[model samples]
Target: MGGRVSEPTTKASQFVVAILAKSGNIVTLYQLDVNNAFLYGDLHEEVNMTLPEGYFTENDKQTEGNMFISLFVYVDDIVITGNDIDEIKRVKTFLNSKFLIKYPGVLKYFLGVEVLRNDENICISQRKYCLELLNDYSMLGSKPANTPIDLGLCVVCSPSEKDNLLSNITKYQKLFGRLIYLTLTRPDISFVVQILSQHMHAPLQSHLNLSFRTLRYLKGSHGKGVRMVKGNELSLKAYCDADLGKCKLNTRSVTGYLVYFCNSLVSWKSKKQATISSSSAEAEYRAMGLTACEIIWIINLLRDLNINVKLHVELMCDNSSAIQIAAYFS
Candidate 1:
């Protein structure tokens, strides 16, 4: 799916260069995205097909398997990620050999989010994406809202009034999906995405309204992205958060964990726990245990990087009792 187009590199690509320049790292950069990634494959089972652009038919002698896999394309944009500069360059070279390579160096932008590489870190955000979303939804002319959610504005709706609520849900659901993908590079939005996701199944008007609030928040913090800078050598650290009794429906707490490698963020999670905890300590401990599990996996990943973490993968939590429990339980 690697090929070239008329456009320059992604916005994130530009931001990455700026960030790297700021950090004074001898950073090397390259860029490529999945080539006609959609065109490359076909639905294995029965499905309706739609005519694609720049359509070309294969020879009569060509078999289905011989047919070129159409890499999916969104107006020529594609998704590709890599860590090794040499490897990325290699891929770019190979793609150029096959298709016209539009040389967009380094991934400055992906999925509308801007990226910057600074001081041993990679920062990503979607301030621009947010603006576009607002404009696309016609919120550009509408007044900006102050909060991501209005706690006093309840979202509960009755079944008979489902139509209005359902409409809002559909709108918000679409946004939530986008935001969820956005979480890949922006952990700051994880909590809100998680909160909004709970209502996806039966989104009411209130739910949709809150979703708009989230969009407003994004508007305010548009172009924000994570900066995975190298930190204090190659060490593994984890931070966890849990909100006990946060959900009114089930009284279930929300738990979150983030994993960093050599001070660069690698993994994160935010979700509701299965069961309710009796106390803050219990809740914190549950979250800590989950965070530890992630740490273990991260440890294995780092091993492949030729990095070894000698001490315990440190887990940080704001709660003292949780810290004590982690000390004894882990």
Candidate 2:
């Protein structure tokens, strides 16, 4: 059977890839697929098959059993995945010995995404996918912006913001959905995507214009991606900050926190806080506590990684009064 979307020689999606634990210190995640995974067993005795063109002169010696391998047909496609690479290679060899053989390498990218993995971390992104989206939306030629949301910009379209819904309003919503998926690797664009998504159900022309700010940012950050680092230092560290009263619509505080894997950013989020803080100290203290939870989770994940880490995480907050309050809580 033919493989999926990629060239047979270079891609490895025909087989499956997975990582498994070995000896607690070593992890072996092998990827292999049956070359013709479905064509594994010998054919049934009742089936008599004619030989293909040119193989036999009607005088070729017949094997004791049927000539066909087990055929599980799914529109002539096959898929196989297992922990043993040798068994996989053996299957490939057996198939090659019996019929035409072709295979690909480690399963990196499939469908539209490009996947890259290392001991430090795994990175998945769709730069190609986004470019396609941009080209489809005629945004490939638009000027690039450095940030997803401009600090100078404010949402002003309102009160009958309904009147100017884009004739292409659905297009605007579609791009928002794509961009929101992209935020999985780019939390830096979170606040922007979240803000634009607020208007997706009833997007106006002004709303549509404001949404492209993220696409502009994506244009510039074509190379930006997440990295999880493997490090000798195992202590969790978190940094939290707040821009007091940043939301223009309400006096809500925007809480931002960064969680690190060693020194690398693994998870971080920025969103408007739910409740109003009575004082700057209270806001800062709240940020520290939220980020502290992040630190604890990271520490536990590291333990799962078998790093044998301690729970001595530092939650950094700039407000001295907040720090003083933290000491009281501790």
Candidate 3:
């Protein structure tokens, strides 16, 4: 018997790249599922073998020319989109010849994320996932909160006052893990989730309270999600900001960035800096550096997909000092 191996999967960012491309260009998005999908290698020497009960052989494709096909694969599930309809059909047929395939018309839902096509733009959300998360945690009836966390609240690792640790640490871990996944379509809660994730090892009661508050916040805007709009050009821009000494425990800065591809946000992150910054300007500079790295990666990704970015990538930093430093370094 031959052992089965997983297919070479594309990066998760490719999904965002596909969405951005579809919004800006004339392309059709489609989904495919391969029955008993498995990749096999050729035998070194010729060996005769009988077909096991029911078995068969199959095929694949790539992107080029006016015919552009962006394929994203996760195990057996596949998403295919391209500028040329004829090319897409040819590719689909080729795939079908090699393996049993299912054509699910357009890509409406995949991996829990709902894809909705509108006349003007494309909207992706996890509304069903959100509701299910709340229901699972018995938070469906919880009162809705206006914010994920209090604006002025300061979180510390060990509170001066006595605080109790959560008894069922696993429950808190599971809840936190779910919330982290929910951030895929809910960037609004990313910051709070990043903050709470630090205490996963042994969450305290206070941390649980904060996590519940985030759930309440999610309840208030469960329908909230990212929207991908068509852009006039494939230009890249980034916005970066940082809070000096934001982490109460380590005094480390918290930095965040949003990367926009042709006016549509393609990537974002909110996380604490690895090292402490001496000043606000330094923190902002560190944030800018992080954003620059992401922008470079995005540009390379676009280039790989045959999408050329014409203009210079822009980085917007609020701190004048940080900007000056960047200019000097350049």
Candidate 4:
């Protein structure tokens, strides 16, 4: 028996970024927990399933005048926030009448992300999550490293290195999965995690060791996280960079970009280019294009939240030739 279910939900990164962008304002954030969340979704297709002995026991957006409200849903967990307090309460009342829900007073924690706010700025971290992960892997006692990965360390396993393949792939997969989620708050390890993920299909012992190194780095920098300061201008600035032929296995360039709303970092990525570029200029141009797309998306998101980008979106790249090409096109 098999089935597929899909729901519209806000991405973790998108939700975090949106909240950060509006931090220090008169906004209110709250969490709603739905009981038996999975049992409530409408199934589009029919499928077979083995029912448990007590299977029958399971159970499960709007805006106000001049008010902006955002509802983020991950399955049954709902985070409601807006500038209008009355509207938020009305939403909760309406939702509670439809299904069973527990209203958590504030969003202190959700999906492993811990939210902390001060008078000046809002900080998000996964310190508890990191500690739990380290303890689970028995790496809590490991000496902390200064960096997530060794500089100039290329994780390339050749045919002659077949013997170096990890014997148990499940352990590596689980650890890697956790690392992937950790990136929601730990952008510092993003590049290394992106590199490690490429080898999940066939991880080598060396890759496992490198994963350990990431854990050790996490040990040292667990307190580090994204900080969103209040009163920053709602302007977009981006920086895009590329390392030509950085992927040792495929010879593809790596593209990295960081997008900020004023002083707060909202979006960033470290990824390998789809195809090989003949020149560093070409690689850098590709990165610029990707960054532009992200900027456009962020602008639209802000527009939906009733925030306008009045100033020009600044996209910075170090490549002179690539900058000239972009300017000429404009």
Candidate 5:
């Protein structure tokens, strides 16, 4: 079928992590591989495809109904999670009967991210991926940087600096794409990656240098990852901030927010705003609005999963003027 096959959202990983944290030490995570998962998905639109080789539609029938075990599928890979061991086993057995499925006992590695589980906590990291990236750029042995970006470094769209343009545009684009993917588990470099991504279309030498500096920073903290510990509380808390006129060329402010479910860091974003704000208070208010929207979305998602979120979700902002503006507007 030429129709769109809706892939699982990238936030699936974060959600999985949050669930694991909520379950504490009693969680059971099963990794699965379906020989041809796409073929399993019930086609919404009529897809006329000549049977590939030996494959036939007669043998493959679609199954519908509510699944007891919670499953998240990303193309071929699937993560089956639940507390009820019998239910998990039953689902696995059913899938095996229908499709050629391989059940990996525990989720150690999936989507280039590694998972380490102990009695107390679960740790997620992309150490192997980070090392491979450094080696690809011949920066494995480079001195590590303490920070992703230099304290005084200012990156902007410099069209007049024609001589500073990167020689190979494709390479710059490729690096940026890889780094962006790396941010899935590496939130430490999220802000800098967001900044560099803005100039992917016309990357200058300064941009490339900053990207390298980010790589060096990754080298220093290659083993660092997010650790989700067992916690009794399932509180939803968010913190948001803004930098006024952070974008030197466009004069647009940057909004950054981090969200936590209980003590687990579930989501975060660092992006430049579309509209220009005249004052710092206005910028801060905009950031708050953006964060509130995210909170609402997350709350709805949790509700869908049957996890009740605390009615009063905490949203924290440091700016007094922004608080006043929000209170006034309310």
Candidate 6:
């Protein structure tokens, strides 16, 4: 059963913010929890299994019926969102008749992210999660840093630098994992996290030091997060830039991009390019290609949600040569 289960695309915080910004004061959002959601999913393949010790069925077997409602499920946690109040209520009624469920009024918290809303704007933050992470690392009282990573500092792993490696690899892995999750709401640290994650296999002490520095930066800006305000415009805008051959160890360019829907950031990424490029223009062009794909994806998603985006999507780049190359190639 475990191997057969398929996960659904859970709603991202950025998407939620975008939806809120578009909804303005006309739409009402609601949350629903379907108990034992996995049990509700109909299985296509057949396999015999013994019933639980205390359970019984007509023939010691059970099967689920087809799902009818427009629902999004992430494991057991489900979020039911739409503008039609009557339709949303009808779906809840249907689910209640079939399965045990709970309707938590209005969404304030989902997953680990916190949501705060007013009449005109929605603010998303992970302050509670960030603080807990800091305390777990014994950095609650540590001095705050102005920046997450030092721009001039470059980290590289060397076998000869034995004293520069951490004794416990597990601790380094754990910290790295948490920091990756933190990037969800903290775009400021996305680039640094991308750099530090490369050396996860054999992290050096310098990596550990830089990780702590990121923690100190989080301590200073723990309350900072993304805010989406109501707007009349429905437009897509993207900005992409690349640091040519930024990785000293692998000579790979670092690509970074940020995408916004009506001035609200909804998607972003910071990653290393797969293949090495000889020129800065080539790296920038590759970065633009990646950003273009993301733009098209977002456009398709918006179309699915019935959001009419009539304006042509705009792409911004700093390099004129890259822009000219993209223009010529297209």
TM-score against native, each model: 0.68, 0.62, 0.85, 0.89, 0.85, 0.85
State the lDDT at 240 in candidate 4. 97
- Looking at candidate 1, what is the lDDT of residue 301? 35
Query: Tens digit of lDDT per residue, candidate 3, span 170-264?
Result: 98899988888878778899899989899888778899889999999999999988898887788988899999988887999999998888788
- Local accuracy of candidate 2 as per-residue lDDT tens digits, 92-118: 577568655444455354434455766
Q: Across residues 161-242, which tens digit of lDDT does each residue of candidate 4 receive?
A: 4547777899999999999999888888989999999888788888888999999998888888888887657788999999
The clash count for each model shown is 40, 2, 2, 0, 0, 0
Model 3 worst lDDT window (10 residues): 56-65
Best candidate according to TM-score: 4
- Relative to the unseen true structure, what is the C-alpha lDDT of residue 60 in candidate 6, on a scale of 0 to 100? 43
Candidate 2 vs candidate 3: the TM-score winner is 3
Where does model 5 exceed 4 Å of error? 1-7, 10-22, 36-42, 45-68, 159-163
Best by lDDT: 4
Name the lDDT value of residue 149 in candidate 2.
Answer: 73
User: Under the 3 Å rule for N, CA and C atoms, how many clashes does model 6 have?
Assistant: 0
Error of 4 at 270 (Å): 0.3
- CA-lDDT, candidates in order: 0.62, 0.58, 0.81, 0.82, 0.78, 0.77
Candidate 5 at 289: error in angstroms? 1.5
Error of 5 at 36 (Å): 4.2
By TM-score, how accurate is candidate 6? Answer: 0.85
The 10-residue segment with the lowest total lDDT in model 1: 64-73
Error of 4 at 7 (Å): 8.2
Please give the distance, in angstroms, between residue 98's alpha carbon in candidate 6 and its true position after superposition: 3.4
The segments of candidate 1 whose C-alpha lies over 4 angstroms from its true place after superposition are 1-29, 41-103, 118-122, 150-164, 261-266
